[model samples]
Target chain A: MTQPTYDSLKVGDEIPTLTTPSVSRHTLALYCGASGDHNPIHVDLDFAKKSGLDDVIAHGMLSAGYLAQMLTNWVPQSALRSFNNRFTAMTQIGDTVSCSGKIVEKFEKDDEKFVRLELYSNTPQAQTIVAEAVLVLA
Target chain B: MIDKKHIGYNFPPVTIPVEEGRLKFLAKSLGETKAIYTDPDAAKAAGYPGLLAPPTFPFMLEIDALDLVDFMSVLGETLEKLLHGEENFNYYAPIYAGDSITVRKRITDIIDKKGGALQFVISDNTFTNQHGKIVAETRTNYVFRHQ
Candidate 1:
């Protein structure tokens, strides 16, 4: 899995699609454990039902987590320059989500290689463009 | 209906080191067998310095940097009244291992929605290494519910 130098990338290339299962209670728990974010909305089903969501919802970071997968696969593991996104809709249990991105621009700045991406996280009922990002690679 | 005020609210930036074990654990949970996130040698083979973290990894660091937790914690919007309405991110650059990030966070927006409430915040999450190279920036949103 040798990473390609940013020198070879071009505009319009579709970044790979990374998929993760729905926002199961387990996903939130695992995410909370890994990330140390213990918001109960992501854990307690009784609490979620009370909050008006059908059941426990996934953490926004977990949904965004898939996008990170896309980047690690596309560039070198750490090649991801920056990862930022808005927490759009709440993705629930039993929903399948896909994370992907496409190269929007490419150029050299400050004598460094950089690529711009329009990233997204989509479910059957929702489509969210998490945000635009710039990745600097070697 | 309850009111969440954003006026004159902000949080001190939180700086943290990127931990490799956590990324490795996340890759496993994601069922991702990709060597880049799993193996340092593999990532090195892929042209990285070491175990490169996932792109969304910053959220873990930025999440606590927000004033929302302390804000909402005091609002009585307990998990019983909170809902995650939406999320979006703006990336500044790629994040690498051994990098420390300083994020200045605060609630920037508060809105009302049918059947729920919306709260948006700007986590001026900036990553600067010991050498002062700004590695990346992250802005995020957090939504709540109405009871």
Candidate 2:
């Protein structure tokens, strides 16, 4: 997809959403190894049980990565100026996540046009992340 | 409660290479299907010199450069007791596979919330490529939930 132009975008415009498959244990383990985030709370069932959770949980970065994918799908990775997110809830196993973003602000800074997007991701149960991203417009 | 004195403490910097194999592995792990993230030839076709580091890939670099267990121990806490509250990344330049990334981290803030039931630890990490160019800056807020 081509990058969105500054004159073509409007505030409150929603970008295309991206959805991913269920959060399986296999996915979490793969992320643990690939990301080097060996936090057992995400992959070790016994550790999660000892930590007072009934079962293991997904990594927050995994969902955040999904949101990133959503933005990159809309704009090139090079267009990204900043990306931020708050992990509001835990994403559970077997939850298929959907990510969406809307343009919140558009303005010119230092002769460069930019758009700020309010981003979000949710499981079937509840919202897991609330985020914002800024992208430079072509 | 974490000691406020630790605020502004800087961690020893660590540098690691952006390996192509790891980038491909991460892309696969995230279920990323874009060839620009997994194939060098495809990336070149897309005008990228090499496989582009997917957004949030720096989190992998951050953790790989710093041991979370040792980082938490410095604050009198453990990994299991902490939860990710918030994360922010500002990009200055694109990071491609084969770049050497140097990470410098420092504790920026530590405060209590919920009347001490929860403590928030805020740290900022600056990532610079081998050319001495700042590529990205990440701020992470960790919630220490007291049992």
Candidate 3:
């Protein structure tokens, strides 16, 4: 599907569903390289155990990244002004993360169409209410 | 008591280049397969000019390319103890591949959560592209180990 433009949108809309695959060692390593957030807990098993986990854990931000993927597909690419989420549970190496969003409000600001949204992320263990975001389009 | 006197305290801005390699690295890390994030052809299929960034791609160094090291340096933060409690992004537009961004960081809030799961310090960052367009707004909360 093509990325949506500023128009063709309305208030009180819901973004489509997206699923994030299970965590993997290679994926965690790649995240560290991109985010510059090389916390051993996310990639090193020994460090994770020392930190008191069952095994190497996924980066909290990476778990949230799942929501980002959902947002980009639901809204326009880069039309997303900001995407945010909260980490409520520990996403283990084998957990699945799914995401969705709902438009909370819409208003006109400075002659631009602005939409406020509530984004949600769900893990096997818990549901995390990630964040409230606002987007402005011309 | 919180003080508004320092409300406007600003961290220096840092500049960083948006590279195709970095975006691909992030997509690979998140186990993402969207063509927009990895393949220019797929992006074109999606009606984008070319390969674009994943939604959270700007959460990295691209936002800090304007000499804003202070955002990366929290005076009282310890790497051994620092934890990211939460993150929130407010989008104004899509951020794609080959886009350059600069990030300006500042302390937005700091409160002791009363020895709760974590004491929170929130920072607000603003990202501007190479064309000096305000591309995004980021607010992040850092959970410091409680004393």
Model 2 agreement with the true structure over B1-147: per-residue lDDT tens digits = 889999999989999999999999999999998889989999989888788998897777888888788788899888778899999999999899989999999999998998999999999999999999999999999899886
RMSD in Å for model 3: 4.3
* Between candidates 2 and 3, the lDDT winner: 2
Q: Which is superior by lDDT, 1 or 2?
A: 2
Q: What is the TM-score of chain A alone in each candidate?
A: 0.87, 0.98, 0.82
Off by over 4 Å in 3: A2-14, A106-115, A135-138, B1-9, B41-50, B62-74, B115-117
Ranking by lDDT: 2, 3, 1
lDDT of 3 at B106: 78
Candidate 2 residue lDDT tens string, A29-104: 9999998989899999999988889999999999999999888877888899999999999999999999999999
Error of 3 at A25 (Å): 2.9
In candidate 3, residue A34 scores what lDDT?
79
- Rank the candidate models, highest DockQ first: 2, 3, 1
lDDT values of the candidates? Answer: 0.65, 0.91, 0.68
TM-score of 1: 0.74
Overall local distance difference test of candidate 3: 0.68
> Which candidate number has the best DockQ?
2
Model 2 residue runs over 4 Å out of place are: none
Model 3 residue A107 CA deviation (Å) reads 4.4
lDDT of 3 by residue, B73-98 (tens): 53434443456777776666666677
